[model samples]
Target: MFVYLWVLFGLFALHEDIVLRQHGIRFVFHGFALVNALVLAKVMLVAEDLKLGHRFQARPLIYQIVLEAFILATLFIAVHILEHTIGGLIAGETLAASVPSIGGGGMQGLFCVALILFVALIPFFGFRHISRELGPGRIKAMLFGRRESAAQAKPPV
Candidate 1:
C-alpha cells in the first residue's frame, strides 16, 4: 500500500509540476507526495485493523473489493478536505473560507477524484484478497519464482 500510494502521489506531483510550470511557477512537491504517502499508508493500516469495509466479505470477491475501495476513497477524500481546512484555518482564514474546493474545484471534480482513488484502490484490495485466499507468501513466491525454460514451457494450442 505504501508503494502504491507513493507511486500515485508521485505521479500527481509530476502533473502538478507540469501544470504550474505553464504559469511560470516553479513548484516541486515530491516531498509532499512522500509524506502524504506515508500518512495515508498508516491510515490505511489503521482502517484495515478496524475492518472499515468488511461487510461484503461473505459475498463475491469483486463486491468486497469494490466496496472496500469505495469506502477507502471516501475516507481519503474526507482526510484531504480536513487537511486543507485545517491548513487554511491555521493561516487565519474564516471557517467558510478555510474549506477549500476539493479535487479541481466543484462537485464534479470531487467525484472525479473519488473515482480515481476508487479505481486505484481496486488492485490493492484485489491482491490482498487473493493473498489471503492463497495463504501467506504464496503470491510473493509465484510472482518472483523462476520462469520455465522454453523446452518446459507449454505450447499454445
Candidate 2:
C-alpha cells in the first residue's frame, strides 16, 4: 500500500515539475521527490492508524468524506511546509521566506495543495473503508480479478 501511495506521489511530483519547468521555474524533483513520497507515505500510515473518518460512520457519507479529506490534506500540507522550511534552512534563508516559496504562492499554494490532496484521497480512502468491511482479499479479487489466498489477505474488519 505504501509503495502504491509513493508511486502516486511520484507522478504528482512529476506533474508539478513539468508545470514548474514550463513556467521557467528553477525547481526540479531531484532528491525532494523521494523525500516527499516517503514523508507522505508515513503521514498516510499514521492517518490510517488513527482511523479518523471511520470513527464517525454514524454521520452522513459526505461528513465522513470531508473529515477524511481534511485529515489527509492537513497531513500532506504539514509535510510540505516542513519540507519547505528545511529547504529554507539549507539555503540560508528565513523559514518564513522558504515556507511559502511556491512562487510566493503563500496561502494560495497551501489551499490548492490541500484541495488537490483531498480530491485525490477520496477514492483511495472512501473505498478503503468499504474494502475493510468486505475484506481486503475480496476487494482485491473484485478489483484485479485475481483470487488472493488467505495468507495474502488482510484480516477482515
Candidate 3:
C-alpha cells in the first residue's frame, strides 16, 4: 500500500523528472505529487481487484500478468485523463482543448507513462504474491532488510 505509493513515487519522480514536472508543476518532497497523480491507483487497483479474470479458474501466469498490467495501465491513464480534463475545465478551456492534454505530449508520451507504469506494476503485483507466500514481516525484512532490536523484542520483567 504505502510501499507501492513510495515505489511509484520514486519511479515517476526520479526517472521521469522533467516530463512529470511539465506545465509549471513543481517537484516536491518524496515525489508526493507523483503519488497523488495516481492516488486512485491504490484505491481502484489494490483495495479492490480489477476482476479482469476469474481467480478460481486456472490460467497461465503470463496471461494473468498481461491482463492485470493492461487493466491497470488503462485505468491509470483514464485517471490521468480525468485529472487533466478537470484542470482544463477549471481553466475555462473547452473540452476539445482539454482532451488533448490527456494524450500526454502525444501518443509517445502516453506510451511512455504506460510503459513506466507497467514496469512499476510488475513489482507491485510481484511483491503482493510474494507477501502472501512469505507473510508481510518477512517481506518487510527482505525489502528494508532490518530486524527488530533485541530490547524491543523482550518482555518486561
lDDT of each: 0.89, 0.75, 0.66
Candidate 1 residue-wise lDDT, 6-113, digit = tens: 999899889889999999999686898888898889889999999988988888888988999998999888887898899999999998998878677898998989
Error of 3 at 132 (Å): 2.7
- What's model 1's lDDT at 21? 97
Clashing pairs in 1: none
Q: Which candidate is the best by TM-score?
A: 1
How big is the positional error of residue 142 in model 2, measured in Å on the Cα after superposition?
Answer: 1.1
* Candidate 3 worst ten-residue window by lDDT: 47-56
Top candidate (lDDT): 1
Write down the TM-score of every candidate: 0.88, 0.72, 0.63
Q: How accurate is candidate 2 locally (lDDT)?
A: 0.75
Where in model 3 is the C-alpha error above 4 Å? 16-38, 45-50, 53-57, 100-104, 133-157
Deviation in Å, model 1, residue 26 alpha carbon: 3.2
